[model samples]
Target: MNSMQNYLADTVKSIPPSGIRRFFDLVTQTKGVISLGVGEPDFVTPWHIREACFYALEKGYTMYTSNSGLLELREEIANYMKKKIGVEYSPQREILITIGVSEAVDLALRALLNPGDEVLVPEPSFVSYAPGTVLAYGKAVSVPTYFEDEYRLKPEVLEKYITPRSKILILAYPNNPTGGIMEKEDLEKLRDLIIKNDLIVISDEIYAELTYNGGHVSIASLPGMRDRTIVLNGFSKAYAMTGWRIGYACGHPDIIAAMTKIHQYTIMCAPIMSQMAAIEALRHGESEMRRMVDDYNNRRKIILSGFKEIGLDCFEPKGAFYAFPSIKISGMSSEEFCEKLLMEEKVAVVPGNAFGANGEGHIRCCYAASIKNIEIAIERMGNFLARHRKG
Candidate 1:
């Protein structure tokens, strides 16, 4: 018999736990540690949304949903996308609700990738894109983003990486860690490139609704892009329903059908009660989202300004709740900075290199934390840097 470890799938062996998980683990062990590491929202799921799920359970709607998702939920998601972001989706054949945006990302890679297919992923973004590509036996080509560019994907950088093997582009905007959003024209350049290059796009847009800037203009909303773009979004960031494990992928009918086929064998369906709750969240939870977005925007300003005053090159994060700040002034490696910040200051943030090779000299701090906590973390960071600054 093969050894216990060797029997695991090669893909399983290739991945690490997560960049942010280790910091939290250390925080758990340390006394008085306050974490700003994880990108999860600090707010609780709205009571009405939770009540809907509980009501479904009380009604015994606990069975497996349709493999794609509940029809009502899919319909609501379609309408929600249209009304909220101007992206029209057909409920019938365009949406497949998976676990979370994480699962949606995985399905997109698996359904489209043959081994060795290269996926160009914008860096210092979400942790999942490259790992999901790796799990699918595809190559995740990391295209680094610099502080000067505010971590937005440059079309020229993407063009430099396109090879015969390059088959997919993973675009994440209103991005994670960096809080960078590619506006309408930025997305258009990518769309033009994809059209000319015959490339498919997997857009992980879980942070869609959390934009401090007015409205989210989806890459999938751009002309000629929807047909080739698999848009990944979920109730996690926007609805504060991370634990619900509910998310959806929308694209052309053929891609949706293929993803549904894979999900059928893997998950069968998401939880019916969660589906019911998600349906309510989409249909009747507009005000809940609005309130949360406003709160997050207020907290965002506090965190960005705090980081700037502390003398970190805090990229003005436009979307999502995290700030990516350079730590070069301290002259410590990203890992060293995080380790020492946790050990000395009892504050936690993830090292940039943890996200990618280009993440050197930087760290990710989540402002999804409470304002008080962000203030405290920022103060601790300032003290730590002040004490460590070399002549």
Candidate 2:
């Protein structure tokens, strides 16, 4: 035991396993558990994109691509970002293809952080931000965003967390777990704050395409922010290409160069076939992406209404596929409520506390499931709540 402890690096050993994956794994062990725990898109990759990959493979395009990925795909990504989000990045120096948003995020942290550097993170949000910062030998300072604020990070709250050592601000919108997004006005607040603090920003926009009603805005598109922000985006959520493991980051040439150095040594390049498919997704997959988003919007309506019918206080999620609702009425901690709900009703939702301490007394339900499944889960939840309240 002593020998094993000595061999393991304390940095790696000190980090805890992902809390979201813990409950997700538990659901897999149980029979007939209706899982709304994972933030995965239920839709499969668009057929044309898959077909393109197959064509690439049959044509013997299996060799490794340039470490920065195929030039053609990066061009398409730049064009897509320009037309869609109003941001322009150089395909040559500012864009680097990655294994996925996960790898892009890790690369961003690794490329930027120095020992004891502070990264300001907004929560309850994605589970990976803080851990990635810690692994890079930086401190993650959580800036709490509340349900009352629609989970949007405010300048006031953010100002309190900034310090002399602060080096980065990690922002993800159309945020995961909470589905909260920062509107243009909301971003203006932080934009001023970022310039004032002179902080680099790691903006994760993986769920940008899943936004409903309102469109997703890129912080990189804001005035004077392009050079200082590393924008991480992927085809997973929007194009239903999660299994393909493809994503990319766009930033200033120096930062992109730094990230690519790590990517080249570690990943070599994203799979050649996946890169081919992503090009198709970027050029011709807009309609398919819209169709999936529309379906999700319908399902979102059903889930939000069902929660209301069950007497839960659910904040209307404007973007992403999650619905975060308070379970305070059940008089149980989020973990207890989720476990009992799964054990009794066979429905699996994530305990909100898994996201952060501010997420306590709540639970996250992914609405990416089929409408029938969502309806059934909500019905079972109603019964579970009724029973628990009576006791």
Candidate 3:
């Protein structure tokens, strides 16, 4: 058995299990725990969207879609991109439906990376970016973003990380963990650096619809960035279709073709019913999605206020359904703070460092739960803080 362990890939062996999943597993074992840990939406997929999937099932639409996905779904995605981001794509050639945004990210990394190529990933962002880069045999270099900068990746900060071998940059706006967003002007600031460096951008815009402070901007929408940016989005967050696992990637035809080659061999296509439901989501699910966003915005306000009242410093999250509050008053590392809170208060949240090193001394509290749970969790967290706070 010990010798057989050597057969495992070194890259796979190096990566640790997801920190988020580790806490989630612990929560499942504990009783009476109110979880604010996972990044999933609390709302169910709207009835109409579910109905569409049911209709597809009744119509016997169960089979592998074209490796690129159903043309109709691709067309809907094209229309969605044009309307939302002011960018147009050839659905037939530039879009490849993926299992989820997770799969899209993986595909983009695998298709674009050469061994030892560097991928510049902004920290306090998603947990998967760095590991995914590693799995693709690429180097993951962290570019730390701070709360003082509203967690936006600044041009100067980014430029310092670029090297001759830095082939890709992963941008996740309406970001996870910290809930930071990069507005149009912010993206424009990075445009020149990206162009000069000749880097391909994998823009993960899964939370675009959840932006509250202003409209979400795609780096791809900026002049000269279209062909070089691979846009990944899906029905998971906005449409509350997490279990459905439908996502798509849009980029230059050559890149899309390359990604599709891997995707066909590996994933083949997203579920046919999910594709049908996503079409309904793009066409008529807007009102429901907006309703959910409005509710999350309300929760966002409550959670921020709750943190303030508890004397924790939390940055204003303009997008997404999470509030990242500093737990430094307790003088504990993020993991210690979260574990103690979960054990004592029975309130669960992910440690900030799970996202990256910059996330240390903070905790990611998802506000996607019901108002009552949010209120209760806040009170419990207050109790936990009072006991652990250092002078």
Candidate 4:
């Protein structure tokens, strides 16, 4: 087996396993752990959406959808995008359904990058962006966004990272780990820079519907960006449909065609039943989705208050269901803090560095868990911190 390892592709060997999953494996081994690690919604997929899938199955709609996905779903996505972001997309030519935003990310990178092209990824981001760049034969460049800026990517900072080799910029706001969001004005600042550099953007708006402060904004809606930006979104976060494995990408027809070529060969189409469920979600699921978002907002307030009471400085997260609080006060690295808290208090949270180096001094506490579990976890964490506080 040691000799066989030599035959592995260098690209595959170069990438490390997801740090988030590695630590969560330890959580699985521990009993009675209150987990605040995974970013998935705690709510069940709304009953109406599930019923739609069941009805589709009863009607014998289990066959493969077109490689671009069910036309109905794509049309619904088009309407949703137009209403949500004021952007128009041709469902036939510009939208391709994918196996989750995960697959959409991979497909976009694989279709867009050439060997040695640089992908500028704003850090403390979702864990997959860097590795996805590597897998696509691109160089992943980290563009650090400070907590002081509420983790929004700044135009001046982004300009410093651009070089002749930078080809793509990934925008994942309502971001993972940090729960940061980019408002319309923040994105407006980057518009000229993006156009000046001739770089394309992969805007992952998977959490678009979860924003609490105001409406979610897509760069694609900005002037001159519609043609250069690929928008990725899905039913996972908002609809609590993570297991459904359905997402879609909207971009220029040329880019969409390229992505579809790769997706057709690799994934074919998202599950047909899931596609059926998604159509119902877009048409009639907004009320339940809003109710869930309202619930998350309440949980968000409680967790932020809990961290403040514990003497951890946590920024207010305006979107997404996470609270990132600095753990430096405990005088332990993020890993040390998380591991000790889990072992001593049976509360599981992810170390920040798992997302990127900029995350080293903080810890990501997902508010997606129940309010009861979140409260208990916070109390446990406070106890653990008091015992472990350095003089």
- Flag regions of model 3 displaced more than 4 Å: 2-4
| Inter-residue clash pairs, candidate 1 | none
Measured with C-alpha atoms, the lDDT of residue 133 in candidate 1 is 88
Residue 290's lDDT in candidate 1: 86
Task: Please give the CA lDDT of all the candidate structures.
Answer: 0.87, 0.93, 0.94, 0.94
lDDT of 3 by residue, 36-145 (tens): 99999999999999999999999999998999999999999999999999999999999999999999999999999999999999999888999999999999999999
**Tens-digit lDDT string for candidate 1 (198-289):** 99988888888888877788888888888888888899988999999999998999999989899999889998988898988987888988
Better of 2 and 3 by lDDT: 3
Task: Report the candidate with higher lDDT, 2 versus 4.
Answer: 4
RMSD of each: 1.6, 1.2, 0.9, 0.8
Candidate 1: stretches off by over 4 Å: 1-3
lDDT of 4 by residue, 24-45 (tens): 8989999999999988899999
Give the higher-lDDT candidate: 1 or 4: 4
Give the deviation of candidate 2 from the true structure as CA RMSD: 1.2
Q: Is candidate 1 or candidate 2 better by lDDT?
A: 2
Q: How many collisions per candidate?
A: 0, 0, 0, 0
Clashing pairs in model 4?
none
- Kindly give the stretch of ten consecutive residues in candidate 1 with the minimal lDDT sum: 80-89
